[model samples]
Target: MTQPHHDGPRTSVRPRPAGDPAATAALTLGVEEEFLLLDPTTGESMPVADRVREALSGTAREQSRQEFRHSMVEMVTPVSPDLAALREHLVALRRAAARAADAVGARLVAVGATPVREAHRTVPDEPRYHDMSRRFGPVAHDPAVCGCHVHVGVPDRELAVQVCNHLRPWLPVVQALTTNSPLHDGRDTGHASWRSMQLERWPSIGPTPHFDSAADYDATVRDLIATGIMLDAAMVYWYARPSASYPTVEVRVGDVCPTVDDTVLVAGLVRALVATAVDEVRAGRPAPRIRDCLVAAAHWRAAHDGVDGDLVDLRTGRPRPAWDLVDDLLAALVPALRRHGDLDLVRREADRLRRDGTGATRQRRIMAGTGGDVRAVLDHLAAQTIAG
Candidate 1:
């Protein structure tokens, strides 16, 4: 693999206000979501991402980019302090992507993995992705999987590392709530998020262990890269980690939600969680000491059953109803949510998801209604992807 170019160190010269800590360290948020492009009539995966990119050229070039597979594309939102504004930006971007797909005789579905498509044969014409394909073999070419990554600003690297440790246990809960991929290769995988399982094949992809300090985190990452297990910091696919390029901690647990409201809900919860963790560190509280093995088990359970069955509650390390665990997480983060003025919105959106079920459940229902027709599942996902 060719070494990536480095632009040298960036030194921030901005002045900081003297008085209020919260005012100085306000948490901003952003989201990156991936989608699969498919043939509109056949619901089969389409390698038309280049065409979609061409359609979005000059208008949303900064907002959208091609992914590793030609069947996939990713959109990223600019950082915003307001959740509503973030949702609006995401909606506009999704609409733009949908229009671009339409112009190319394709459709965009925002599920975690394409339901009917087998492994994507065509890799994007990029050096890094080509290296990944050559190194990882078939795992890199599997049915394109998508995810929703939330970045919450923590400017301070030490705080970001501490927040990553604090956020580790709760990741499974978030994953359960955002399970959007239950089918793979035209059949039910029985796992709520087969995408999670697929990603776990990579060495660096899962719950990260607790790091005592920022230095510790950096050393661990450097060691991993040195071993040839991964190529660079970008390949450290932990469920939550400090962003390599941005001054934020990125949470990469959740599946790409189909609905705008659901995506907003996940982003809001992620920001609140980061804010809450920052407060805990500021207050001199020690990070939670959950064992990494238990955390991995919780992640596995969430990926397997989603919110439909049981989850290993981190508080007790015992199996509990998934919704109960979700409620517990909300209650735990209430103070942060209230502080950010996102309490009401998060509550309402979460309640709606619980009432209607998550994307995985909806996909199953749609498939059942259409006598297990994968096209119906694709149609439902595409409709929900554009609905808000």
Candidate 2:
């Protein structure tokens, strides 16, 4: 990727006047969700992603790509200007992928990790993947994990990098809202998002540091590359980063959600966060200055308990109920959501999520109801994956 001029993101792009959402076309959003191909009976990952990929047609085939493991595949939505359109696109794509999986005798499960252990660890035949496996060894096992990535368009690369700075603290709260992986390797991990824990095995995966400017961000990336820890810029697994290819900021903190509604809620909140941050940047406001360890603690707490337990609120450095932090996040983003015409959608879905609880809580409930049968949880996930 060619480096662009770094004059700061706010040099030419000022805060928008309070106007219709349609007037601000640059805020278009996209989502990418990774899924696992599982054996319907055993719930272990099936190494038939190539067959499923071949079966996909139309939009699903066009927008989808293979993940590192042969048991995994990723489907991305097209750039959507509104939450409703994003929902429609996600529904269609997921349905198409599910159909393809069925045709190949595999069940596509929208989950962060398989309930049962996958012994195969089938790495793809691609050269880059082979190199990764050779270099990283056991760390390559982490790619078996799935995640939901949200991409929000910005005016330029500079703006996207700066937005990531403002987004540092909020990533943990958002991660808690979408926690889905509770059972892993046929056992309850006692953590809401086991996938989040799995991801940290990779050297590059963690909280993004606050960058003073795009130049500062670029310098850090170069230094990491020089250390030979990461293969390239694309390998930096920060919670959020400026897109390597698109003029957008991609937030990769949340685990892949169970249903379309959960995914949509994540996208709406993330975009609103980015919009609010952009406004502050244009207004010459400073980003939050909590210590790095506190931000990491917040992330760890979110992964451990999700919505079922307390989170360390960064403001006071004290633990608060997870729900309270979620509500505070919503309150902070209301103006941005309203400006983007997504206020009602976000609010409604948030209430529903609160009532239904995080995916981890639901999984635990099912585990108890079924007398500790892990297969039952997989069955529930299979049905929810294509329920749209």
Candidate 3:
């Protein structure tokens, strides 16, 4: 189906800023991850969501968004104030999810990308997925890809948009650190993250411009809706956007991390970035204008080289080591890091990635040693699939 078109720019009515200290203090963290269920031996996709749901059975009530029709099952832990608690919750949730999958003759792999995905593995005859396949064609039907999405409560819409803009510079760094999908369709894609590149094909998907205020954002979303370019505000699908359902800014960069520690680290980084951005914006700080081409170029570099890429520092056009830039960000976020009590977790995981390399790197090593056999990579992924 062809998407609708937009004619011209629209006006925005900035919402009156109602800055509340209490609201900001109550900022909480929530995560939504999408994963693929696969046969442990074959590495082919498995349609065992129903069996997994039955496994969860009575426990489903405790987990939010449980019992999915797709081969994937998701869990949302209760809101937590610190990373330690969040870590524990995710660990337990993973175990429950894995146990559910195991009971149904399936296994869960928590990686950014699947090296091989059979299109036929898609949820059989599900209307929603069928409509999605029809709407996005092969993009939605591909059963190999998965992603990690982080949501941080902003309490204010204008602050959410500002957070989205400030987040632009650090996005590539996040992508590089979380790079996992180096192969697609049983072939090496030569890109650090094939998933990131693939998702960019959808309309209005990517980092958007900095809006003046919440009214400006609402007007733009209204225009997109008016033109029928999107079914609703939720369909904006930009890399970062003011979430339609929650009072939070959603960051859709990064692949699914292998460990709960890594997920917590990414979540902490996102929280710090959003908090810092809100402070700067509320204090009347002017944001640097990042040209669309420059942003796209940075994404390409991160996708191609992963940690090996010389990412352009948005603050400075000069190139720097991807690891070096992330270190700087971690240092700059020390205040928010302390606030969230996740500095140690973030630092440790970042150090681990910097030392051993990302999931993509390890997958490539296995493929090279095994003569481009996708099974070798899947074997490793399956071993890690048993939840922490």
Residue 323 lDDT (model 3): 78
TM-score of 3: 0.87
Models 1 onward score TM values of 0.93, 0.94, 0.87
Query: Model 1 Cα displacement at 85 (Å)?
Result: 0.1
Query: lDDT by residue for model 2 over 109-158, one digit each (tens)?
Result: 88887678787785888888888888888888653788999999985776
lDDT of each: 0.85, 0.86, 0.71
Q: How many steric overlaps are in each model, in order?
A: 0, 0, 0
Candidate 2: Cα lDDT at 359? 82
Residue 153 CA displacement from its true place in model 2, Å = 0.5
TM-score of 2: 0.94
| Global Cα lDDT for candidate 2 | 0.86
Greater-TM-score candidate between 1 and 2: 2
lDDT per residue for candidate 3 within 266-317, as digits (tens), equals: 8888888887777666655656767767777787788788886678787776
Ranking by lDDT: 2, 1, 3
